[model samples]
Target: MASDIIIVGQGICGSLLSWSLLQKGISVKVYDIDADHSATAAASGIINPITGKRFVKSWMVDELFPAADKTYSEISQAIGVHFYEKLPIYKLLESVKEQNDLSARATETGYEQYFTNTDVQYLDKGKVKNEFGSFVINGGGKMDTQLFINSYRTFLKNKGILIEEPFTYEQALVSKSKVIFCNGYKAAQTGFFRDLTWQIVKGEYLLVRIKDFYADRIISGDTTISPTSEKDIYYAGATYQWHYETEAPTEQYKNEIIESLNKMLHVPFEVVYHGAGIRPSAKYRRPFIGFHPEYKHVGIFNGMGTKGISLSPYFAEHFAEHIVNGKELLPEVDVKNILIKS
Candidate 1:
């Protein structure tokens, strides 16, 4: 019933935070309402070092990428699952303007270390349309989020730390030294972050079976495709919608993604599965971290948005350190500095 830390969500954020806390010899009690369609489950977990349009380096690629790789690798070994893989992303450009903009931006940002204007003539001869595009092969890859969560959950359960049910918010107790909320989105309904703008977007993706286009690398364009190594099975997805009826997959999104895929590839494929989840994106797109102003013990580690895979590890360690050792939080990402005043 009591723990040094009570985490109310077993998604990537909560899972990683729990792991970090346990590593520091802290007792963590994690509560979750089983898995729902959320970014962690639906995420392709791609950690691109460069942004798509700007081709600029990610916010903290030099640091975050290495830390993420090391963390995932260590955790994967401990849990006996392949959780991380380094893959080069082949970005397909559709128009001359996009190509030009990419080139100019790369030059301006000195992103040539990753970006190059290569003759993708081989791809041009394929059935798909190609207006000629540049390639930016950066050091980034994907995380098997679902596998990681399930494996970690099992690990925690074996260690007698996981509670596989929804935590009742009414049970949460907030005191001067500690505060707890039920889950990430549930915090919104609790009115804790009423002043903070939450831009919850629903995203959907489909699994497809396609033969002969197998590659260890990840392909990103209008629609991204990740090869799963299962013959003729690949993860192709993802449509982002600002407004949606529910967090369930829709035929409208499936058709749109499939149509987009048809435009990029010449091969035939069969639709296998569809998944949808709502991402807890913030208005400013930075993660929401810190304790409540009025409630000193209440803290949050949510809002990594789509970058949860890359962001969670570093921030989790940072947060755990802050909690355990009285260390100073990072200036840019410290939650206390970013909290919206009520």
Candidate 2:
């Protein structure tokens, strides 16, 4: 069947891209192997507004956050599934400096909505490591990333627009459809987007069984512990390994995560599941979006890195507009930046 577009890799990026295209009344034939170790599958899908060592705001959070909320809400309603979670991100104060940084931001006018300096106790029971206290990020949320993508996949299948297989560039045009690579870190192996400086790394997390633990909001310490789609099973993780030999789970990092969790959490917990997946993080920490220089019909939409959950929906819509209307992508993320150096 000749379709308007053929998207590769049905991760968050691909799924959002397909949805955006489909919403615009475009036909999209998706290709995905549905790997068990995909990043989207392993992700807790927490959409944090502020992050990093200094606890600064995430890139484009002001704009992207609201768009994501709207997109997820509309999609959830359309599919008859509840995947988006609107909750606070309680950042545990680890040190005096970290405490001061947050304090300074709370007084600032622009940061008022996202940061609250009011003395609040989210997890201060000595069981979850918050001796210094924590602040609330008002508009933080999470999405059941895997659940949303999987459900959307079934929706596409019913529409006769899905191919449950890996796509290779060799099969393009022979099928007469524009192919956009929405595959995550796997795109690093393909030569088409080799100009992109990928800082790919495998991230590890755990699905743990903890009794009577309240998961009203996400908790952060050395690692982030967010609620999973399932009740009572929180997603605890993630550790980054630059020199990992396999994307498969490792016992060393699993124990490492447990150690970190123990510091934040004094409770004894059992590891119900361990998951590891590679992120397509960019060297400059920007997404690689837009078309190939030589292959006009081939485009790359990867390199979302750690912020894929928050960033993908906004960019997916932008990318769709670009494809459908020949609109301009911001110079920073434009694929022409890669071609300029090439």
Best by lDDT: 2
lDDT by residue (1-342, candidate 2, tens digit) is 455798898888888898999989898888899744578887878888878776678888898988898888888888888988898888888767767778887777777778665554457474676877787877789887778877887877888988988887677635466889888887788657866788997899899988777678888887788887677898898888888887789999999999888888877788999889898998888899998877778888889988888999899999999989888998889887777785
Indicate the residue-level lDDT of 35 in model 2: 44
Question: Which numbered prediction scores highest in TM-score against the true structure?
Answer: 2
Question: Which lDDT value does model 1 have at 158?
Answer: 88
For every candidate in turn, the CA RMSD to the true structure comes to: 2.7, 1.7
Stretches of candidate 2 exceeding 4 Å from the true structure: 1-3, 120-122, 173-175
Off by over 4 Å in 1: 1-3, 100-124, 174-182, 340-342
Q: Give the Cα-based TM-score of candidate 2 against the true structure.
A: 0.95
lDDT of 2 at 173: 35
